[model samples]
Target: MRKRYLITFGIVLFILVIDQVIKFWIKTSFAFDDPSVPLIGEWLQLNFVENQGMAFGTQLGGGMWGKLTLSIFRVVMIGAIIYYILKQIKKPDVKLEFLIVSAMVLAGAAGNLFDSMFYDFIFRDYFDPCISYNQVEGSGIFSECSYFGYTEMVEVRHRGFLFGNVVDMFQFNVIWPSWVPWLGGGQVFPAIWNVADFAISCGMILVLLRQKIYFPKEKTSKE
Candidate 1:
């Protein structure tokens, strides 16, 4: 039981650290408009982008209120998962695989939540030419406008708690063949995601694939 707990804790800590390191590196090193850096041929690349919504850039609602709601939802879900893990750990028949998957999910959720809660306050030096003072109607938000043939420094302000954008960097450059239906000639899995998103997706996929092992059916007593 103690070994299992240590393993779970290690996995979650490792994932969270790796995810945050990659995100911070991209946030400081890459510009939004910078060309994607090829990693493995033309198939994989580092494409820096910020997601203001959920996975794959899907928004729950509009503007700041929506972001706050999403962040709150994540907190509730994480709390429930933690409770479930504790209960399962105490059970004699609990499967280690189940605990591992739960840890992955928990860590992934927490990783993104950290960004939503603190990225705005931590990352204030970022400047983008596309979103300048005149473009956005706000006082605290400002950027250097080199894209418009002019350049100027502007004061930067935090976007407040739970309103920071999630940084995404990895992208698959694969495109669907023309023979495909609606997605013909379009980028295949075009969503730019981060390490946390990948971890959550892998954890979910493992759950689906190994459901039988993780949740074995109970034997019925003879009538």
Candidate 2:
């Protein structure tokens, strides 16, 4: 691959890896069932969050069906971006930058999708504390709940399909004064996101800025 393409891919991969690592750590350690843990007194916190789909802290939902549909749509979109990038390889000099941006966007989208597709199978619900699954006092709570299969009080709240819901965690809030009159910051947003989000953001910013600095010049050949 060319240098530009490699750089973009590298950045995308780096962001994806870091994002997933942070999410996995939180999944194993924190209990987001109760978010809003106090960190740095009241500013930052280690909270685990899951979103059905959407960018950080936002979601479009009509329930599981909605999420599944969105997930499928995203899969198609990302696939298209990847295809576009591969096609651009035929004209490396002309299409390097486009390839880079598209690849980063694709990678970011895929990284988050990976979480939505698999996290549910391995872990239980996001709202419940992990302790609920641990075998307290050695007898094994699941064994204790063995009657679930035959009992009338069986309440099974299972995590849905891998793509059933997207993994979203990463909410950055900047508190502005309420006295500003017309506009003051409120609660800000919903879920916490990961590095994939950052990669996409950076790629988009670069592409937007690139238009001005690298915009094509009109042909001024021999007249």
Candidate 3:
């Protein structure tokens, strides 16, 4: 069954769980706009930030409505990609690398989608800690200062849509060299991403570096 569709589905779901767990921790323990919670100094952190955009808060789009639309669009895209991956895996000349890469992509997308869809709506009640200035430091991106936190600290699943931003809490940065271009001499890596994002990056890079292993060069019509 290692070569079956179940393997791909199982792996993808596993990665998605890890991604959401980490995000849930960050959202529950910290506030947005926080650069670092000092997990291990400047090297490691549990920073909290939000994005109405794509993964890692990179691909920004329109307003809240726009983000909601994109979230729905992602479900459709991931569904299509999963279908393609399973179909390819069943082919006689299926490439293992391609199948895995597709799985990686689907997993990362699902992980982030969970937050954008139900996280803020239902899980919001859970993330909120003590409802006071001493506990949460009176900080939340939410507009209401009074209900900034849970009054009695409950964990009720909210009904309907919330459309809150996704949690991204990983920070890795590098100072660009002055001799480079556009962003030269600038600081980077404020992006707080999850493990699924890392998995997607690694999978894509591996596939690109070994392109011939997946799609070998085709002979010309002259051949």
Candidate 4:
């Protein structure tokens, strides 16, 4: 039991630390809506933005209440995950893959939760308050810019709990040619996300890709 928990904690802690560290770096180093700094030409770029709502910058509803509801929902989900993990740990035949996948999901959710819970307290929002979700107004990646960390002139007025923005940095600007379907040479996969989002996405993908392996069907008593 101790070993199982240790492994679980190790995975969650490791992911949380890395996710927060990178986000911290991006948050402190660059401004919100900063131009895309290509790491691999235009294919992969570092574009900083903050998500005040759901994953991948999607808005949950409208105002502060919507944000709070989303944050609470995430906490509920995290609690459910913890309960599931604990129950599984007591089972003798629990699969390691399931545990790993759950850990990934937990870590990712916690990472983003931290941002929603406390980032507003720590960092000042330079973005125009009227511009909700930083919704893109124009075409192409160059149209956006990120705010560097808070300046002396800026005041850090934290939002009432669980109302901060989830910082996103990584971008894959895969613009297909004009002939390509709806893309029209525009960016494919336009959403910008962070490490936490990646972990959750990867974990879900693993479970989907290996559902049978992770959760094989049991033989019937008659058989």
lDDT for each residue of candidate 2 in 24-97, tens digit (9 for 90 to 100): 77777766465655546555555556555656735455444556777777778788877766666655355556
Name every residue pair that clashes in candidate 4. 31-146, 31-147, 31-148, 32-146, 32-147, 33-145, 33-146, 34-145, 34-146
- Positional deviation of 192 in candidate 2, in angstroms? 3.1
TM-score preference between candidates 2 and 3, better one: 3
The models' CA-based lDDT, in order, is: 0.81, 0.60, 0.66, 0.79
Q: Estimate each model's TM-score.
A: 0.87, 0.69, 0.73, 0.83
Best-fitting candidate, scored by lDDT: 1
Model 2 lDDT, residue 28, Cα: 74
> After TM-score superposition, what is the CA distance of residue 55 in candidate 1 from its true location, in Å?
1.8
Off by over 4 Å in 3: 33-35, 38-41, 126-162, 177-185, 218-223
* Cα misplacement distance, residue 22 of candidate 3 (Å): 0.8
Clashing pairs counted in every model: 0, 8, 0, 9
Candidate 2 stretches greater than 4 Å from native: 1-6, 34-45, 95-98, 124-164, 185-191, 213-223
Model 3 poorest ten-residue lDDT run? 131-140
Which of 1 and 3 is the better model by TM-score?
Answer: 1
Question: Once superposed on the true structure, which residue ranges of model 4 sit more than 4 Å away at CA?
Answer: 124-158
Worst 10 residues of 2 by lDDT: 133-142
- lDDT for model 3 comes to 0.66
